[model samples]
Target: MAANEKIKEKISHLPHKPGIYKFFDENGIIYVGKAVDIRKRVSSYFNRSAQHNKKTLKLISQIQDIEFTIVDTEADAFLLENNLIKQYQPKYNILLKDGKTYPYICIVNERFPRIISTRNKINDGSRYFGPYASVTTMNVVLDLIRTLYPIRTCTYNLSPENVDAGKFKVCLEYHIGNCKGPCENLIDETTYNQNITQIRSILSGNLSVAKNYFKERMAAAAEEYQFEVAHQYKQKLDLLDDFQAKSTVVSNTLSNIDVFTITSNDKCSFINYLKVMNGSIILTQSLEVQKKLDETDEELLATVIVQLRHEFESTSREVITNIELQLPLDNVTVTYPQIGDKRKLLNLSLKNAMYLRKEREGRQEKNKDLSEQREIRVLETLKKDLRLTELPRQIECFDNSNFQGDNPVASMVCFKNGKPSKKDYRHFNIKTVVGPNDFESMYEIVTRRYKRLLEEKQPLPQLVIIDGGKGQLSFAVKALKDLDLWGKIAIVGIAKRLEEIFYPGDTLPLYIDKKSESLKLIQRLRNEAHRFAITFHRSKRDAGTLKTELTEVKGIGLSTAESLLAKFRSVKKLRELSQDELAQEIGQRKASILYNYFHNVA
Candidate 1:
């Protein structure tokens, strides 16, 4: 839990106020969080806590710098956190599952406006409302608006001058009574504007204006003894009533509130949100938050609350949840209801979250089963192709590497169930082999690997692969024979020139199909072994070169040479230092000997 001194210094100076904090590594920001007290929240990560998961520990290990922006209130912190996450998309933050935007009802700004549903929100002067979670609901709203008010549905540019010059004609919409023919000036500007105003009220969740208008019109028609006109008004009023009834899923008393509930497993959390306005549930959405730090349900719920509210432009002052939260939301009431309509709303949201969680778990389990079956099938194919008594479930490949007869090394890579078993991979330093003898190096490494396994009474591999032709395979077989494991393990050698496979006693090569799964698996093992051996050889060669250069100085032992190289990193850099500078690192006596040796001075 102890962070480096640099991180500790930053943590000590964090201000005790509301803010958004970002954790950055050498690459970029890795995590972002909101906190009522920045100092306490950031310090919690470095404290000894059993609750920290492996992901959080890794994030803490990579943090190079901490940045924070002070805000006026916790609500401001929440908003800033949401904005920063959307901007940076940090690796350790919960992201919305889908990137699709919800639908909004846009009232286009023009001489005669048209009401339409869109997923994009432009920054023009037009008014947009209802980012409805369901497009069907949005379409229902649009249809009702069209039925109640005969506004224009066409894309005609109905400017004052265009209408006066008779640039447009009445379309079929006007003849069918769906439009007021605003393009042909059949409806006056003031009258068309009155309909737009009432439509705006309906979109804003205030149906009282439209309902009252229809009631007044119906009364006027009835007073004149015109039953047909009055019946039309009655039908319009019933439409409004029916829409309200469907939207108001809970009590009519709940207005301008948000209800949230969360269900989580060890790896992810599902959050469901219900947005209520004017005593009606206008929006309901469920989101999947991929867990990065094994965050508690309360912490995840808080994040979702801020994100969903900002995305949907919710202005609710009250929030109901299934679990209590300790967040400091400015001018907002957090309630956990026990027994009421609000409790029922919370239960409904929780059910949605649970359903999403179950669906995700089932999908993951199915994927896992499919992966296991595929691995088994590949292993079975490999077993039949090689004609082995038992399945080659555990296979090991050996490779030798050297640089022009210098610093020879070998590597052994293991594969289990047709996949690389990195934990069992071993590197050898070519013990008992002189110069660049590939055959002896392979034999020595093969003997040393299994002799130790035999000594430890560990299980042996079912198959062994050598990355060379008959010469290398013969030596490996001899080593196995000497250890009484010659016929026990199925061994083969693959040559690089023609990709030929050779048996222990067989002279001619056994060439499997080029596209066969068995051949591909063998190629993968050989490539991995070669790569591992080359990497180990390069590192050893580099270290030896650095050591030999410094150790050439008279009276300089391996320990001093290693110490110097560790401090200066390279002999080339060591040569650039003056005797005085060298003396500061080693004593003046050894420093003089090393300096004169490098400078060729007496």
Candidate 2:
């Protein structure tokens, strides 16, 4: 490396002003910092009096350029620093780069203001509240508002043409007392304004006011001798109290700090920021571009703190979530309090952040569990029943449904870990069978399914389950053998009575696993397929039945039956026609013939 001369020149002209600083490498990746005096902060590396860590020394050596932004005050510097860190998540900084945007509840300032979720907060004639952790939480709060208040939640775009239009008609919500029906102008401005005021009061950490309002309503109802109405009010008041108790934690300095967490399988990061003013979270956003490849949880936490302290101007003694780290706090103090109310608040914020992360993760795991559950739960039971060495990782279930053998359809619902794998779901329409021939339908469906699987060069399942007993199981095995996949995939049949499971060629079923969740899982999959196929078959059969009925009419031969169906829509409508009218509309002779055929026949 070149001598330390180049680093000195960049630090020399640094101004002694309160602002944020950025250090850039040759590749233009930045490491940002904020200080009260830029000159002193930037010159700290050159100070013979100060000692820096090995990582800091390494970072100083890589700096190719230095840049700074001047701000009005330390607070301004602090806020700006956080904004820049979030924008340019440089190396040597703690980055919480979950691409999740904050959700705000936007109550528009309009004639009929609408409550909506937005990621952006602008002065566009609306009141915005919250950088709520998730849209789910915002929605929950919104649902509460809708439940308690009768304020209109409709979009306020009523035009002159629609002034009297029925589009503003009162919905069932008005009758059920969920809304004041502002769309229909049922409630006046003063009452609507009062409701909005109540919403604001409830949101601003004043839960007691809402509770008091409910209590007053309860008292009024009790005085009127309406016990049922009084009970409802009391219940609502109790719920409000519960909500307040859960969220109302007192913090040190009365500052609100939100901790954000982002975790992948092997990596976890926490970002902590304070919201000093009303509903604005400090540094609530971040971007992580160049993250650690093999970073331990502790290292990640340390990196976050060093970078966060460097980038954020506010050094208020606010403890970040989970991760403990040393920070510089001469002008302002940074802390992670371990005791009293501050600790409670810190822990609550951390828990909420972790819970938000988990809820997001749980949704993805749900999809995977659908298939994997089968292997763990279903196959475990199967192994115990069959005394197998290993559990079945791949399971294939086949079902057939039809209406009198018309438009017959078969479905295959696959499970990898005792859970449904929608990606592996396959559907087959019965082409060979006619008039309720389930065995033939099964054979065709199984043969066709396996043929496609082979053509696509896909692996056969470890276990195959047919929705019927020995006959259906044998049919599946035959298909497998024909396709040379028989010995590869295990075959079994799930019998209908008590829903017992049986292997191919077995006369008896193993229904003794009655109380097993795995058995219930298999039964559910098989039943789902049966239900799906039957629905399709019934739809096709019904259409055929109606057409068959229409075809019997003399004037309504195949084309006329099709036309009448195309025109009148249903057989029930055809039943409503008078003989004379039918004769006049169609040909006189043909109509008379049709009228006699339909009305007089049966």
Candidate RMSDs in Å, in order, are: 4.6, 23.4
lDDT by residue for model 2 over 133-224, one digit each (tens)?
54665676787777777766556564434644746687676788877777766777677777787788765545556778888989999999
Model 1 superposed RMSD (Cα):
4.6
TM-score versus the correct structure, for each prediction: 0.84, 0.45
Per-residue lDDT of 224 in model 1 = 100
Q: Rate the local accuracy (lDDT) of all candidates.
A: 0.89, 0.67
Which prediction has the highest TM-score against the true structure? 1
Cα-based lDDT at residue 192, candidate 1: 85
